[model samples]
Target: MSKLQEVFKNKSGNVLNVYCTAGYPHLESTLQIIDTLQKNGADIIELGMPYSDPLADGPVIQQSSLVALENGMTIATLFSQLKNLPSSTGDKEAAIILMGYMNPVLQYGFEKFCKDAAEVGVSGLILPDLPEYEYETEYGAIIKKCGLDFIFLVTPETSEERVRRLDLLSSGFLYAVSSSSTTGNEKDFNAVEKYLERLKSLNLKNPILVGFGIKDKETFNTACKYANGAIIGTAYIKALEGAANVEQATKKFLAGILK
Candidate 1:
């Protein structure tokens, strides 16, 4: 089984997936951030690849992407850094998933990108802009051939039929966007509970991981009640913005979510 599949199979609920931008805060902080997150409480690490234009991201993540780019982060640099990561690091290991747009991957050569990702222990990819039909027709075989999971996103407006279809296509987990807006929007759990209920009724094959607006323990717990876990991106980025220590900030932020 892939590392991502093993994570979900071993951990049933409240799986905290933390999103961090590669080369953010500083250039060379990528592996350190992942190590800290894994040691803290993050069950999955979604590493954001800096992009010029990120449509699904909010201001916080957009700024992070900009800073990461400014720090000289590129697909090549990220792959090299990941490849250099230690082969074994005790038992505290979080499954890694690269989250970014398709343009960079295309620029980096899709097949080569997937091959490099797998070679470096990356378990999945989350391309927000990769449409389901296009992926199935063009890149699905490539992703699967590289032994990588490709996660799909679903919004409240998504039709049941489409959600089911996406569930069929998605591996690892389905990212459930809490609202129609971009990431980091303020969340109202009561307003989102109904949507969560709708998704829970679908009985998707892949586990659902609610994202966007999940900031603290209250929101995390509420989301977990309906899905297998929750993803925190913007909030964590905010925490990392001016923190004196990235590791400490990560630990504290995850504590707030999993507490």
Candidate 2:
């Protein structure tokens, strides 16, 4: 089983998966944020690669990405920042997943990106814009050969047949988009519940992690009750913007998850 699948097995027992954009708010803050999330009980961490044109991101994440890029965050710089993570995370074994568009990966070179990501401890990737057909036809085998789990995202609009196909293709967990929109939009619990029910009934091989608009404890609780875990982003970034230190910000942001 992939490390991500193993992490989900444990989280299925009881845990939350948290996602945060790398190099957001600042460059070095990425390392500190990952360390903080793991120390504070984030089961799985999604480190987003800041991109120039983030079509799927809401204003909060889009603006944060802009600021991150302005601070000179790039794939190479991100890899450099990640070199400090193993020591920083201490004994935590949280599965680290890189979330981004394909453009940056192409620019960084696919083989190099996969190889270096594995070396840096990234077990999986979430690319929103990469279609399933294209992935299967082209990049799927290469990513699998590199030992990377190419996580698939399914929205409210995704069909059951597609879900089954994705379940078969996905090596780790399925990222269930909470609603039919970008991050920071209000999560439609009704839509999320229906999707969760469908996914559970399908009995796919992998577990599911709900993302987008999972801002606080209530939403997190709702997601975990229906799915394996919840992935939070925009709200956490907003908290970091008002924080004195990244650690403090992470502490405060996670405090809500527990409360």
Candidate 3:
């Protein structure tokens, strides 16, 4: 089984998947952040490949992406850095998943991207802009061939039928977007709970991880009550801003959520 699959099979709840912008804070800080996160409490790490037009990200993450780009972080550089993740991190506990826009991934060549990702010990991918029809027709086979899992996102507005369809296509956990808007926005927990409950009733094939507005312990715990876990992105990035120590910042951020 993939590392991500093992995580779910062994632990059924309170799964904390933290998202970080690769090459953010500094170009060479990718491995540092990943290592620190897993060592602290993160079960899965979603390393974002910074892109110019990150349609789904909020201002904080967008600014991080801008800085990362300015610092000269590309997919090639990210792969090279990830190549040393094992030796740098000490112990590889958390499953690493790449999150990025399709534009950059396509520019890097999709097949090569998947192969290199697998070679560097990446477990899965989260391409929000990749449509379901395109995946089934063109990219699904390539992803499966590389032994990489693909995660699909579903919002409260998604119909039950479509949600189940995505769950069937997805290999890892299904990302349940708390709202139909961009990341880092506030959400209505009452409405979010009803949505999560609705998703739970569907009996999806994959685990559900609620993202967007999941910034603290309360939100994390609240999300876990209905889904398998929660994904923290914007809050964590905001924490890293202007911080002197990335490792210490990551540890403190994760502790506040998982401890």
Candidate 4:
């Protein structure tokens, strides 16, 4: 089984997937961040590839991406760093999923991107702008050939038919956007609860992980109520914003959520 599949197999719920921008805070910080998150409490590391234009991200993530790009973070640099990185933290292996826009990846060459990602122990990908049709016809085959999962996102506005279609296309897990907005925005748990209820009732093939606005213990608990887990990005970034020690900040931030 894939590392992501193993995570679900071992833990039926409360899977904590954390997102971190590559090269954020400093150019040499990517690997350190990955190690810190995995060693602390994150079950999955959704590493964001800095892009000039990231429409799906919020201001916090956007700013991080800008800093990462300014720090000279690139797909090649990230691959080089991940090459020496271990996949497992002792017995449990944390799944690594790259989150980014399609433009930068296409520039890096789609085939080469998948090949390098697989070689570097990447478990999956999340490219929000990749259309379903293009994926099924072109990119999806490349990803599958490299033995990597591709996750799809669905929002509250998505029709049941569309949600099921996305769920069918997704692997590892389906990322359910808590609301129909960009990342880091506030969420209405009442509406989110009802929406998650609908998703639960659909019985999707892959497990569900709610993203966007899941910032702390209370929100994480609420998100995990009906889904397998939740994804936290902005909050974690905020924790690391001005911290003197990234690892310590990561440990404390994760402890607050999973505590």
Candidate 5:
């Protein structure tokens, strides 16, 4: 099984997936962030590849992306950094998924991107704009051929038929957007309980990880009640905005959710 599959197979509840933009805070901070996250409580690490236009991201994440780009974080640079990461940082048990837009991957050559990601021990990918039909016909085989899982996202507005289709296409875990909005928006879980409950009733083959607006312990716990876990991106980025210490900020922020 792929490393990502192994993670979900062994850990079944409250799987805390943390998202961090590559080269953020500083250009050389990628591996350090990953190491700290692994040593902390992050069950899955979604490494964001800096992009010029990130449609699905909120202001916080978009700003971080800009800073990361200013730090000279390119797809090529990220791959080079990943390739040279210490063995300790590429822990066999920890699953790392590269989250980015298709433009960069296409620029770097999709097949080559997959090959490099596999070589660097990346377990999966989360391309927000990669359509289901396009992936199945054009890129799914290439991704799976490189032994990488391709995760898909689903929003509240998604039809039941589409959700199931996405669940089947997704290999790691299905990213369930709490609402039909960009990341980092404030969410009241009580209002979305029925939507979450409806997803639970679908009995998708892949595990569900609710994202968007899940910022703290209360939201995290509520998300976990309806799915396998939760993903924290904008909130974590907000925590790291100007913090003197990235590791300390990561530790404290994660503690608030997993504690």
Candidate 6:
């Protein structure tokens, strides 16, 4: 099993996943932010690849992505940044997952990108635009060869058959988008609950990590009640912007979720 799978399995329920844009605020800040989140009890880290066009993202993430790109963040640069991560210490070993779209991977060459990501300790890749069929046909074998877990997202609109297919092929946990729209958009809890019920009815083998619009303790608790874990993105970034230090911001964010 991949490190991501192991981590989620160990944590079981109420896992806190954090997302950040690579090279945002500053290039060197990428590792620092991730390290901070880890120290503050983020179970899994979703490091945004900083693509030029993040279609599935809301304004907050889109703005962060643009800033990261302006700071010269690219696939190669992100790998380079990962290579410079600090040595592991204490009980703070967090799995890193690269989240982005497909164009950047194609631009970087799929095989080379996978190889580089593995070399730099990324546990997996989350491609929002990668259809299950296309991945199975083209890059699935290559991704497996590199020992990288490729995650797929399931939305309310996802069919029962598609959910099963995605679950069977998924190595890491499946990302469950809370709503049909982009990340960070708010929707009814009833809708989210219904979606969870639908996913449960499918009896998927892989664990699920809920994402989008999960900003505080209430939402996190809601997600934990059904899914294996919950991911917070825009809220964490908002915290990052408010605090003087990344560590301080991470602590505040984590405290809110854990409370």
- lDDT, candidates in the order shown: 0.92, 0.83, 0.93, 0.92, 0.91, 0.86
Looking at model 2, report the run of 10 residues with the lowest lDDT sum: 84-93
lDDT of 2 at 172: 82
Against the true structure, candidate 4 reaches a TM-score of 0.98
lDDT tens string, model 5, 1-259? 8888888898888998999999998999898888888887888999999999999999999999999999999988888898877786345446889999999999999999999999998999999999988998999999999999999999989999999999999998999999889889886778877899999999999999999989999999999999999999999999999999998988898888888
- Cα-based TM-score, every candidate: 0.98, 0.95, 0.97, 0.98, 0.97, 0.96
Model 1 regions more than 4 Å off: none
Residue 159's C-alpha lDDT in candidate 3?
94
**lDDT (tens digit, per residue) of candidate 6 on 116-220:** 999999999999898877888999999999999988898889888888888888878888998888987888866788788778667688888899889899988
- lDDT per residue, candidate 4, 1-259, as tens digits? 7787778888979999999999998889988888888877799999999999999999999999999999999999999999979655574557899999999999999999999999999989999999999999999999999999999999999999999999998889999999998999995777789999999999999999999999999999999998999999999999999899998998999999988
- For model 1, how does the per-residue alpha-carbon lDDT over 103-221 read when each residue is reduced to its tens digit? 99999999999999999999999999999889989999999999999999999999999999999999999999999889898957689999999999998899889999998899999
Per-residue lDDT of candidate 3, residues 1-259 (tens digit): 8999988998889999999899999999998898888888788999999999999999999999999999999999999998887754465499999999999999999999999999999999999999999999999999999999999999999999999899999988999999998999996767889899999999889999999999999999999999999999999999999999999888888888888
lDDT of 1: 0.92
For model 3, what is the C-alpha lDDT against the true structure? 0.93
Off by over 4 Å in 5: 89-93
**How big is the positional error of residue 23 in model 5, measured in Å on the Cα after superposition?**
0.8
lDDT of 1 at 252: 88
Report the Cα RMSD per candidate.
0.9, 1.5, 1.2, 1.0, 1.4, 1.3
Q: Tell how far residue 29 is off in model 5, in angstroms.
A: 0.9
Model 2 regions lying over 4 Å from their true place: 87-90
